[model samples]
Target chain A: MMHSLLVEGFGVQNWTYVLVGITFTLYIGIAIWARAGSTKEFYVAGGGVSPLANGMATAADWMSAASFISMAGIISFDGYDGAVYLMGWTGGYVLLALLLAPYLRKFGKFTVPDFIGDRYYSNTARLVGVICALIVSFTYVAGQMRGVGLVFSRFLEVDINTGVIIGMIIVLFYAVLGGMKGITYTQVAQYCVLIFAFMVPAIFISIQMTGNPIPQLGFGSQLADGSGTYLLDKLDGLSTDLGFNEYTEGSKSTIDIFAITLALMVGTAGLPHVIVRFFTVKRVRDARKSAGIALLLIVILYTTAPAVAVFARTNMIETVSNKPYANVPEWFKKWETTELIKFTDKNNDGLIQYVADESKNELFVDKDIMVLANPEIAKLPDWIIALVAAGALAAALSTAAGLLLVISASVSHDLIKKMINPKISEKGELIAARLSAVVAVCIAGYFGINPPGFVAATVALAFGLAAASFFPAIILGIFYKKMNKEGAIAGMVIGILLMLFYMTKFKFGWFGGGTKADWWFGISPEGFGTVAMIINFVVSIVIMKFTPETPKDVQEIVEKIRIPSGAGAATH
Target chain B: MSEKSNAKAYWKENIRYVLILLAIWFMVSFAAGILFKDELNTIRIGGFKLGFWFAQQGSMYVFVILIFVYVRLMNKLDKKYGYDA
Candidate 1:
């Protein structure tokens, strides 16, 4: 059962052990220090976390397994066009901090539902928020668990399914025991490891290729080989020569990409798991500070990704081109066999041009594999590979735990307790939350076993859903004074169901495998979510205008949320 | 009421920045991807066409830098309004 890589001198066993030891110890340390007590502690760390610490945790939370592993891989293949995720993800934080974070913090809530419920004065609005939160969190978490399985399988030498089951157990243990307080502290540690792991490879690779240790600048700078062309430029040239769109241009319609980017940007601002992080800070000022810090940390990774993409592409292309397929390195052959890196051997020359030949060029490699495969491609030592394994696992496990807690919260906090049993006790609700986390993990593990094509695509679907469903409600609830209960709930339901229908119909042919011709308004599922977002906003505004005025007390609430006045020392 | 005028000025200033920033966002992604793509194709800044690079790399770097710029500007504005924490 030993994989060939394990057989080859990479003692993945030792490396994996080191990785697990460090992660387990870190999680344990965080749990003991940031112990939870009241339900508030479980929900939002009792609003006492420092801006820097919250920022660190937020960075880790925001940069999931896909960002760590697949971003560069995607960028390498996607070229400059792939910058949407990088830009959208990072830029969205600015919108979040300026427009959303401070007000949400001042609202002083446990979850997004808590904010929506209190704001609209309706159980229905709370329930709708809960449903949207659950959908977005679950869809995102499933991918994270799958990422854990992949990393564990590679490093621990276990079957993927076993790796997933083990991951589920570890995530469940910490999440149930510590809740937000425990997860936040653990995530701080995860941020350090994931960023260091990401940068080390980039740094090492940059030094080798560009003779520069600073990866951010070096990637766009000229290659060390003195070819006069920057690594990025060379890559675009090489790729386009083979008939691919220049790495920086669009092969798809511009409108679609524009729409998708907007959706992702808004979606990031509105994500329940992400927004709820603001509640963990002590005050509105702390929330804004935390947002700034989070943006700072995220930019480091986000900026470096484009460089990593160019560097990785240049290096990968150079390795495969013009070489005899047999004489290629062992990893090349291994990847080829797995169909991760396929060559058509055009002209039967026994060499892969790896050019972007539109018709005949079949130099197809799963873009997600690029980041995971980097250490091996560079022929770095085995420990780096093991370190990567650990990094990917941390990225996956940390985010998965966060998402599952949110899902379980939606069910226990917003739906069952509020609607079905308003009389539910704190203890009973707590127990229900724990049980829900376990069930949710099991379901996520199932999807991990059968991950849908490309992690990025799945994540995009999650973002689109959030943009369509929760974003309008949250943004409107904060900015508009007149938004009412019925309007908010209806907007959420219509937006969510419409987005889901569009996603399923286009992505899976939900209603009898509809063809492309069946697409509504030529909008792909990816773009449809943005359109749905507009509908929600317009509908909410128009309905609020027509409806009777909000309760007189509602103005007081908005006034309270805006003022950074002396609320006295924040009591946890 | 005078304070309200001050707050209104602050709001207008913020709006101006947003409008300018939005233009950059559009030019990088939408304009580069659609309208100006062919124009960018003529200029090879290294190995990539300018338009393609904008879509993938240029816009991202600008976004990161913009966050810091906004932060700096907002901090100054906050101090002006006595809102600095």
Candidate 2:
């Protein structure tokens, strides 16, 4: 039946429409079925979600379009330097499980700020948490919205802006109606769709190139062509031939790699959306189990990514490097129309030169195109390509909804209920939550359409901001009973301000815009978060020493959170 | 044991497990994957250099294992402290 549909002129775009249509309808249906009836359900899925389901939802929420689409692409380009993301991202779960998640679940809060406010005994700290969450989440969401636009523009042939608007509407519909309840189940379905779509192409290509079905092992095995050459060895040779660094070698300095890895790990632990997922589960033990399950699911993709990077990089260079322009395959031409792949034919030569030298190279390919173009480059089936489209949308939309939830929760629960309108009723707060989600979606859409100059730097900025602002506060709140509100507030303000100052100065060339040579202690802005984090720790400790001790009640709250029993459920 | 001291004991044991687990985490990612990567790269396992594999694949696998191990240890601790409920 499927082959007959294709034979009847149902092309890639048609298949994409069908798959995406089905998935979108499924998401909407799930949303309506699971719509939240109260503030608790909207905020934390009523705090009765099973560990297995929560794990799946967390996995889907964590792996954004960046992970699904851009990670492999970036790894394909950066080679060994890209290890920071792999290790950095997955490593954070260890910290989350061990250091953060269980205790936060025990605290039984609706949001991160709720913990901050109550633990520190101040609305000021909560307000700071809210601001930092908004900054990190909004910066992160812009990239996701762009991912949605990129997929729609390429697959569905819609205008990028139109795609952003469409994505905004769909996200608003589900996020507002179902709240966290709807988002959780929809994300579970999305995780399945995305992982299947990601793996099928990877497995097919792995078998074709290396005769191994497991992509992780295939990347480390000898090629299938009986050349007895290892895949990585062959890629290294190909890279050097084009004047590029050896495929397995690192060009980034050692300290920068360490800093970047640390920053990402800490940032991952601090992300409010991911941390909030644990609050939905029933017990402290379930929180820990669910975190483990989430990481296990996430690693399935994280581990496969490098292998996919190697395969796609090797395949891309072999197909296009030094090849005649006229003989370029159909996929290249298709991508050319999207301007993601461009050929200028320098020196009036018909051959495509993809050399590392910028002046001499005539083929310019966007790194974001590698994963989307991989199946097509390998001559996979049309439905598989369409599957990638739907999968990309699933990844983007799930993460966007998660972040939007955090945004709305911050506004309605933290800012309005806790700060502005403490007398507001439960029903009023629920309405406020939904309305804030609608407004947040619009702002996210605007950024997606007219992305800021720093969109490319967003991952670094978001993670860095989270690392700098949230990690120290939460960790201190949990582990140190004496940590007072003054210390926490001062540490966060200084930490975030330091990160922002460094990022804008280095990334945007603000404040007289120093170059690479002037980077403090040879750390890039991407890695500056690690330094800022340490400073937060030091400042927090020193300030705590000089300031008044935490009140007896708040200290007792800390003692209570440390114990795993009696975690019951997350409550306001 | 008194309730306050019992809680303290549980907390202390939990911290010990975390520190040990976090040490392994640091060793795998920061030490093996980054600081000693070049040294480890001299050794190869099939097509993968030891260090590069650790950076890209091995450390992540270790991290997953570390979490589950921590979970097991914590669950045991909870049971011992009568907090399993």
Candidate 3:
């Protein structure tokens, strides 16, 4: 087999080069073959994508490097508290399928701002939508670029800056050349690559730990070593032995978890890039079906994540706890060279103590390295380790390409065609789209190379901002005919400003930088989106009562979208 | 039925379905997974605490099922309303 041939004599780094080369070639080939020819094709893949293909594309677009690399890693450390992300990220699709996708598909627009501008009958609302989309997409994409760089620097042994530049070039080639048509197909290929890459290691580790091939089931099964103790029971025992919370017991406040989960779900539904995927499908029903398919595909990884977390966490603790630094495995040293895993012999004992106590802890493991190092820790073959690098790249690049599309579409389509120069020709607009794409990729590349101090905080804040600004406006616009331009604009402005004030104050320590105890109603910045969204809903409705009703034709358009009968190709 | 009322009926039924499904969505994720987690954790299936299972695994599976169910229901409604075309 090609796998065996590749693994036979090549080192892990060499295998990474071969596999990454193959996958990148596949993506670029698809881009060249499926290049967009018209504005419609560029914006929404000519509005002819099959449901299944769109589903796969959306899955790839939705699951970023955070989902593939960091989610399991974070879960490994957070234990039961990690359920917030597991439930939060996936639950949003339910909201999308039920409340958003079909209606947006029926509206038949090129961008989220297009829908907002037309639905609210105001350029002001559209401009706000464009700004929000840009902020969310840009913040989200920067993280993805950094993720790409991280994989490259670790696996391929390149400078992180060089890795960023290479990733930028690849994404620029596909996104600028192929547009949505190109991105959609490449993402389908990427989804396959990433899912396979994720599952292979997980399945191997699951069987090795619990004698179960399925990771989801194996996490709840007994240890494979003739120990009758259940895996979670053992993990809980190990955790408490090391001064950590029990594996299955959460430490977060219930209200905070509820708020965060709601924020992420609403945010997922409100994200412009994910919503735009529905516009590519042929019909409203297809939109609904594809949302289902996307979530199903996403759930495959989401469910396995906690399991991988358990296995990796257990393996890591057993391998390093109280063990001599000299006896540590080669993988630990390799990661240590990357500085992601550090062992400081504070006690001068030369043994690695990985206890939870801040004063006594000797080993510091960065959460981002858990998934990347999982295969190696399990003694898996070099090829599987290389496949993970390729997978992480696939995750990062696909999401970056998706967010770049949103950024460019918000600019050329929303800012240029709608607001700035309505007289622009289709050809002119397509050129504008391509040019903005190039510019967006450059900016995204810059951020990747030189990430801002708040890149991580901003990525989470992107969700909060989306949930704050977009979800309420879109929801009221569809469900309530009385929703007017004045109401939505006011609601969005206040919601976004409130969310920004809260996030910056808490997350960035700006605006007189408050601590966690100062959080409003005990809701953390991550979960503040729920409060902002509720306020937006209330502000929109209350203002709508005092303001003028929606114009007659706009109400009729709302009626049309509700029926879902004729979801034709998206237009300008 | 008149077109106006016909559209209204379709939308109303759609909203009803959405409400029911969203209720299930909330039940699994927020209620069982968070608010009532400690209560549910008292019960265990295999090595999994019921609430922890819901939070980490069961809620996601239910979410996928909910979406597909919504799709199926909406598709049937569209057909019934003669909008499937």
Specify the highest-lDDT model's number: 2
List runs of model 2 lying over 4 Å from the truth.
Answer: A1-9, A453-456
Best of the two (1, 2) by DockQ: 2
DockQ each: 0.35, 0.92, 0.93
Q: What is the C-alpha lDDT profile of model 3 across A10-103, one tens digit per residue?
A: 7799999999999999999999999999999999999999999999999999999889988898889989889988998899999999999999
Candidate 1 lDDT by residue in tens digits, A233-325:
676678777677766664656666667778788889888889988888876667777887887787788777877887777777788777777
Candidate 2 RMSD to the correct structure? 1.6
Q: TM-scores, in order shown?
A: 0.90, 0.98, 0.98
- The deviation in Å at residue A227 for candidate 2 is 0.6
Q: How many clashes does each candidate structure show, in the order listed?
A: 8, 0, 0
- lDDT tens digits, residues B9-79, model 2? 99999999999999999999999999999899999999999999999999999999998999899999999
Location of the lowest summed lDDT over 10 successive residues in candidate 1 chain B:
B46-55
Ranking by TM-score: 2, 3, 1
Q: Give per-residue CA lDDT, model 2, range A394-496, as digits (tens).
A: 9999999999999999999999999999999999999999999999999999999987642335766789999999999999999999999999999999999
